[model samples]
Target: MNAPITIDTPRTRISALATDHTALLLDYRLRNRDHLAPSEPARGAEYYTEQAVASRIAQVEAEAEAGSALHLAALDRASGQLVALCSFTNIVRGPFQACHLGFSVDHAHEGSGLMAEVAGAGINYVFDQLRLHRIMAAHMPRNERSAGLLARLGFEREGYARSYLRINGQWEDMVLLSLVDDRPGA
Candidate 1:
């Protein structure tokens, strides 16, 4: 499914993460490692390796096929480099139609609205194509950028959680937010 789903935007090309595309993913991760380390969970050295990325991509592909999750890579078409990534994970169907959203963009692309461009399209795909009712996203309380981005995406503040996640090795508090598909028949 990841290999087949692709969305082309005016400034970027968004495609599902595929195992065969390890080179692009590896390049992106390597380039953004320092830039993304703050908000991301602490990872071992192996996490940055091509073999690790390929293995992760393979897992995502399997999850996509099973209708549980999707990981998308956003590329700057003009520069031909990956600029961002977003994932819809922990997808639950049946009566509980929902998933969690997580994303990161190149440091250079920050404040350029690339994350919004990619994540907005991803949210639409999740709501319309996947028919999920809700998307939950959380960010460190100190990260105003993420808070603003989630607000702009129509994700209302839900609550706060203490030590909600481990980021940069230590436990961190999170400001929870959620966006619900409220369109008619959703």
Candidate 2:
């Protein structure tokens, strides 16, 4: 299995979390609870606890060891505060060679192109490091920000799904998009 990766962008340092960063995960979750509550499922207050975040960190790290998934966090280069997160989950190798992408940005960094900067790096890592042939992402129909970002990233519109996911206790329609890596030997 490959080790967790770290990349330095112009304004942020992006890397996967380790088991020791439980407090950092807790703080990031608590700070973004309100900002992320809409699209994510409710995990109650317990989910924001340090123990829970530690367990989750362990879980994702194990998945990384298994080559099944990864979660990359981007920290501000100056302050070291987490500014964004990108997850590439459900990695299927064999003949599929694909995975699902999810992301969120700090509300303070919204509209500042931070997500694009971080997510672009994540996508490149997925393709180059993971050697995945394709990456899939979906966003709610009302989320024009996500739609525009995916478009700018060159993800093609795959198809619209009706009630594709149960988000925030409600079934929501999703606009699915995908990007394929067509480089030599991909």
Candidate 3:
């Protein structure tokens, strides 16, 4: 048998959430629809539909294959259960070497550190593994939990953008946070 793999985020596994994982993702989204509504900041029920989910999977796959972006679904290593979804989108290579982080956790699993674990792993991958210099995440000001998580992960608050995104309907302000890998050795 192959030896068990180990990762920093304790029994947390993140993998491409393709069409194969659509049912799991849809179930979680449906069950926690209300709780997820707040963190979404943008998007709605239509975003969780099977067609949309399949389309997103295709988009992410194409982007990954083209070396443009990376998206992952976080799962419990032991049970192989879906817990959250995260992505690095709007990636700019070369001089920019940066991407934006977006994520959402099942309402039942919030505050369990799973999302944080995923974010930390993504930051490490972007900075060390992919040789990217910076990563950014933005959250609605009222989303205290997300802001806290970003801060705990060493992201510095950059600024707030007015009417950054239309959430549910109204335009919402977003607090931008970033982690820049500017070490001399890097």
Writing each residue's lDDT as its tens digit, candidate 2 over 1-186 gives 366578888889998877766777788888889989998886687998888988999998998888899888888999988888899999999999999999999988988989999999999988988899999999999999899889988899999999889898899999999999998887
Candidate order (lDDT) = 1, 2, 3
Against the hidden reference, what TM-scores do the models get? 0.96, 0.96, 0.88
lDDT tens digits, residues 1-186, model 1?
434878887778888888766898899889888989999889788999988998988898889898889899888999878899999999998898999999999989999888999999999989988899999999998999999899999999999999989899999999999999999999
Clashes of 1: 0
Q: Candidate 1 — which residues are off by over 4 angstroms?
A: 1-3
Candidate 3 residue spans exceeding 4 A from truth? 1-8, 41-46
CA displacement after TM-score superposition, residue 25 of candidate 3 (Å): 1.7
C-alpha-based local distance difference test score of model 1: 0.90
For candidate 3, the 10 contiguous residues with the lowest summed lDDT are: 1-10
* Alpha-carbon deviation at 27 in model 2, angstroms: 1.0
Pairs in clash, predicted candidate 2: none
**Model 2, global lDDT:** 0.89
